[model samples]
Target chain A: MSAKPPASIDALIELLAKLPGLGPRSARRAVLHLVARRSQLLHPLAEAMTEVAATARECLNCGNIATGDLCPICLDDRRATGQICVVEDVADLWAMERGGAFGGRYHVLGGTLSALDAVGPEDLGLPRLADRIETEQVTEVILALGATVDGQTTAHYISDMLDGRTRVTSLAKGVPVGGELDYLDDGTIAAALAARTRL
Target chain B: MSAKPPASIDALIELLAKLPGLGPRSARRAVLHLVARRSQLLHPLAEAMTEVAATARECLNCGNIATGDLCPICLDDRRATGQICVVEDVADLWAMERGGAFGGRYHVLGGTLSALDAVGPEDLGLPRLADRIETEQVTEVILALGATVDGQTTAHYISDMLDGRTRVTSLAKGVPVGGELDYLDDGTIAAALAARTRL
Candidate 1:
């Protein structure tokens, strides 16, 4: 009731509260937790944050976050240059990487084109994709973007852009691997039926 | 996933995942968010952590977290020395302070006496509390400890220890404000009934 917290402690709470899911209450709890274990958590967290702040940067080639100008995927020469998988965000890229199936590189679009937000082809780095296809000799471009209206519109635009040059393919729309037929949505069941493969 | 995150990035995620409420998945999302907003969030947070790491420490007298040897409460001379409020932890002290009802000094016990965990009066600074009662000429000692078994056990021990020196009062048990009688446990309903006052 008497003396307020140190100014820096309040500032720390404010910054933490700005994170994706944390609010003021959770931020205070986290700050208290960190202070209670200063040596174990506070010190290491500070060092780690300083390290990331100084080194983290967007990859020059594909917009993925990396310490260097090139992200890990962009730096890996072993990955196939003939195929490029496109996704709407770096989280999508990380998810595809976790699957460990595709051996190709990725192109992070940052976000889909939204007229309301004024995002356009240039913002999505469409010209960069065009240049990459020619320079990397990419024969196939895989669209791993979501099935939203914006995603479908972007996929169609990309397909038309590379109509005569390289093959463009979108991921199949069907019931998920463990999806139950009874739980499947109408659109999903209809799409699965249209694209059904014979056993 | 293809090329694992840089060492610093992975370490940052691991450290964040260790926080009370955050999990590995949420940690990843938070790290990504911080990295994406390095200038706005990462740098300031790092600076704030470094500041707290260097300055945060426990009050030698009261065991409350403080920047100096004495906590703010101890430093403020206007507070009444006639009463002392004892709490189980710093978080509890903060909660009391937020309530703004107490104008007396505080003594943080760190924890309660627990025979199972081998904790005793010495561990909770009971000796120091006895010294404070005599030194500060305290007339009343308030026990704001929770209603848990350990809390009650500790309260009884303190009440007996200060039997002749000063008045010791534990917080009254009753149904919480805004709590519905229908939703309250039998014990809380009973306590509320027993503590009932004239309207």
Candidate 2:
């Protein structure tokens, strides 16, 4: 079989396949489509990919992606609402933003504290989160974590860590068990954040 | 609401959203995931993407993506089997290869001849294909286009153009109506190729 694609094209297909929901089959299709639409899609995408690859980095303060040391939300002083919304991942923070309801800053935890996975507060930047609560003069900490056991455990730990110092709230309603924040619609995220209940 | 993401991250999201099957929501999630998995997934993917973006180009002869002017398949003298598989796009050719069934080289037509879209034989590379047939001593031309109206029309036109000079066949059976080769399973594609009858 004259099946071996060029090394560069093969590399792209392999990388694309690693993305969520894209297996080898879909990746091959996507790469082919990009090649066919080279001028409109492939070239632009490749250029953008190169640019982003060179510039993208994590915001030092918020764990959000940034071109510089701080993400936009973290840098903007006007975003300080004395409320820092804590999330299991950056996707959750983006979901909160898509709701257009949150006015404060975000603290992406990278992932929930998981005993099975050997993930702890340190791994999730909980110490840094506590420092933010004190330094940023945060009055509230809203937990927008997944509804899984590890998520709840992590939320409880954070609440206890900040006990008596600030209000700790969890998004109420809409989120189901094992439901990822990225899967929630904007309306759902908005409603849940608005109806947040003290943990 | 102070919901806007950083400019560079937002740009990445916008580009990712344009990918096939990835909407805005999924794109954001995907970007976030990449950021979190930077060392393991993101860094490598970014490097690979950058390298490919810089080096990749279309094979002048067959439209397959390559690092050089001509694709490896087209450059290989041993692959000159006097048979060229004519696919509507490069993805179809890739699909055939993934099945490890085809032994001949490929000619990506870029798209099927479609009058509705103001496309004709020239747009689908029929002129170059004819040249390849004559110059390469191609005795057979396998049509691996979709089962759509344009696919059939283009196949008929190519057969007429070659008229009695070479055997014309298509990847047959198991391909549903309007089904693209990229979507089919490897087993199904193999079966289709094996059962392919003369067109």
Candidate 3:
């Protein structure tokens, strides 16, 4: 029992463990599952990863991930709605897409303006955002950043930088669509109450 | 936003979501992380998966996953200790290996007998177990099956079948190590009390 598994299997487990939600134990289980169903899962996953590794790239325009220079959102001609939804990372962009409410394009900031981590506006593609407003004729900049302190700070910085260029708005604060008042924290409840609208 | 990502990226997400612990949302995150860090994580993982897919196979003798016809445990002469640890699945075999306690080889039954699923001894390689006892001169057969009804039933059936051929034993039933008495369930507490020793 002291003998370890094969090197490839061990390496796969190590890499799988580094994924966001999977720890070492579950990674090992996942690797085992993949190995057991090789033709069905492991082979397809390997092939898919190889293909992505060869083709996946960040959009040169908006920093969204795609297989080409411009992401699908950035390349779509019909997405010219004169509105650019700004987000902290590609994950946020995907989240916004999942909501299926935004009909415009996106500007991925890559990260927030964090003074502690030394992340500045330049690092977040603020210059590119301003350029996009002029070149793409954007009339609105929707700040879909998180509710965190850094997120707010970043939003404020972007808004001030684009004060005269375009309208700057933010995603509204309220109890989530399916969330309950009982489960919400004090700050959320307060914000939701303050922003309450008439029926 | 209506435009889908490239076919490869979508395929990767779909395959990843089918893994043991990952769902659609987390799969997207995992795929994004892989694509973003292609050189660091994605390429290596893809290579490892390809290697494992090409080499990994079930041991013809004991059903453990291996690179060849027989698993490493079966091939190692040191593991010929005239004892066989029987388990319901390869996961249990790996768990036992992680403990580094067992000194003998293992026999993965693939799954426990289930009346509802129409599983039987033949399906679990019971005949091979009997043959191995005679050919390998196995003096002990340890049943390391789960505590479920099907697991227990399978264990009892195996024990009865090998009544006089070899000494049959089961994993000890008691409170797990590092477990608190107050948090233990009624069945575990009762079992611990019944199996209490002079220590």
Candidate 1: tens digits of C-alpha lDDT, residues A1-199: 4567767788988999998778988898899899989999999999999999999998988888899999888888888568999999878888888888888898999899888889999999999999999888999999998999999888989999989899999899998998899998899999999999999
Residues B1-199 of candidate 2 have per-residue lDDT tens digits of 6456666677777877877877888777777767666677777776766666667788999987788999888888878999899987767777788887777889998888877899988887889989988889998999888777888899899999988878898766577779999989987788778877788
Cα RMSD for candidates in order: 1.7, 6.5, 2.3
Candidate No. with top DockQ: 1
Clashing pairs in 1: A1-B97
Q: Give lDDT: candidate 3, residue A81.
A: 96
lDDT of 2 by residue, A79-101 (tens): 98899899877677777888888
Q: Tell me the deviation in Å of residue A35 in model 2.
A: 1.9
By descending TM-score, how would the candidates be arranged? Answer: 1, 3, 2
The count of residue-pair clashes in candidate 2 stands at 0
Ranking by DockQ: 1, 3, 2
* lDDT score at residue B95, model 3, on the 0-100 scale: 87
The best-first sequence of candidates by lDDT reads 3, 1, 2
Q: What ranges in model 1 sit over 4 Å off?
A: none
- Model 3, TM vs. native: 0.92
lDDT of 1 by residue, B133-194 (tens): 98899999999998899999999999999999999997889877888888989988888889
Worst ten in a row by lDDT for model 3 chain B: B1-10
Instruction: List TM-score (chain A only) for every prediction.
Output: 0.96, 0.84, 0.93
**Model 3: lDDT of residue A172:** 91
> Cα lDDT of all candidates, in order?
0.90, 0.81, 0.90
Clashing pairs in 2: none
